[model samples]
Target: MTEGRPLRADARRNRERVLAAAREAFAAEGISVPLDEIARRAGVGPGTVYRHFPTKEALFHAAIVDNIERLTDYARELATAADPVHAFFGFLDHWVAEGAVKRDLAEAIGSDHALELSSPVKGMLDSIETLLHRAQRSGGVRPDIDLDDLLRALKGTFLVTHIPTITDAQRRRTFAIVFDGLRVR
Candidate 1:
């Protein structure tokens, strides 16, 4: 029903604006922000937003996929750090802190069946697993822990620290306590 060609310059600009607005809105207000508000923020009409993203779910999924890809890239970069243990824990700390404000995004990814199967998500997990294995082999992490343990610890940490009433200091303290448990005795 549509031509399979590159978008025109104006159309491409409009699409980029829409995605940028959507990312900001989703980060500040979660995925519940109205499409019209996103369109207004992008200086585009609602029809233009709809033309670029057929539904809010589609837009949110795109954002999540984009985030996963970026995180995977970051993990890949961290993988080459001189200290494997520091690299692993640094990645974990950064991930949990970033995810603290993106609780809605976490919930959406957890619930979305399609997103769970996405290659970016899988790549992120694999990268994490490799990091964990490297740290363990270096005797920095406890040998008994595996990738699943690390994931569960991060999920638990995020769930516990992401509450609105919790102060930043409290979150850091809690994360420190949990993270300490992962180190070799």
Candidate 2:
């Protein structure tokens, strides 16, 4: 889609289907899931998957960008919600939950490919920052905190979620601690 002027309606639909399938497949089965399996899951021919994403790295990069774009959009919506504090904390909850699932895909793609994701990651961080500022203005979040600090804490939380056998209660407690620290006491 990025190579052309624009994708036609049917072509756009095909690409989206492929991406949705790829995201689920990669997240569930890792990048080792064959393109043929992705196409089968998408209900499209294998050639269609290649047409949209020529290589595994290309497809993975697209999938990761697509996920970030979606989260950014969601965060932007929540930023203007009636309860800024809830929106901020709720976004963090959603983000961490998503990271727990997506960790496999990121690991399968390897650290080398992750370096190309700066742009979309920046957009995600900016959306979080907007929500943070809104929450702070509402006197729910700590005024002294900044996006950098929040990002560091979020990264650490994501890492914690990578623990091989962490129970759900442990995960919740970990997040509760982070949330408690960020909230204005």
Candidate 3:
């Protein structure tokens, strides 16, 4: 170990703790949450939190990336599920839920030059393509549909379905309508 330059294990722990707390704080309270409150939540000094994150946007980027990775994993799981239809709907539900979190993170992460669309977005799109292909082959989704149009429609659904006050039931209804329209006769 480099005695003079190395951060101790305890110091490293504090850094991670601060990031975790900041994520929670930002999720609950947005980017305007006090650094002092975040430090208190982490059981660290404000300086330590500041040292780890430097800016609120930097902390938000960490949280956003973490969340995107989780969503990506879920997409991978859904892509390989036993029932292709169930997997597709499960992916949609997960997308909506994650989109809510992304909605908040986007306000900060969108403004930061550091943030970019993660590869999972592309992976998820490809997964959706595979699912749609399978469903179409099985006479589930309509054969006449263009994949790009389908993707655009689903993205439109994401935007429409993002309202905070909308119940899951409402989302289900909306999803059903969308699914019904896209299904083969």
lDDT of each: 0.79, 0.80, 0.67
**RMSD vs true structure, all candidates:** 3.0, 4.7, 5.2
Q: Report the lDDT tens digits of candidate 2 across residue range 1-185.
A: 47648999999999999999888887765567899999999999999999999898678777777677878899988988999999999998887777777863234222346524567766777888899999999999999989878867766775666678988788888888999999998
Worst 10 residues of 2 by lDDT: 104-113
Q: Specify the poorest-scoring 10-residue window by lDDT in model 3.
A: 104-113
Give the Å shift of residue 13 in candidate 3. Answer: 2.3
Q: Judged by lDDT relative to the true structure, which candidate is superior, 1 or 3?
A: 1
Clashes of each: 0, 0, 0
lDDT assessment of candidate 1: 0.79
**Clash-forming residue pairs, model 1:** none
Candidate 2: stretches off by over 4 Å: 5-59, 104-118
| Local distance difference test, candidate 2 | 0.80
Using lDDT as the yardstick, the better of models 2 and 3 is 2
TM-score of each: 0.78, 0.66, 0.58
Of 1 and 2, the candidate ahead on TM-score is 1
Better of 2 and 3 by TM-score: 2
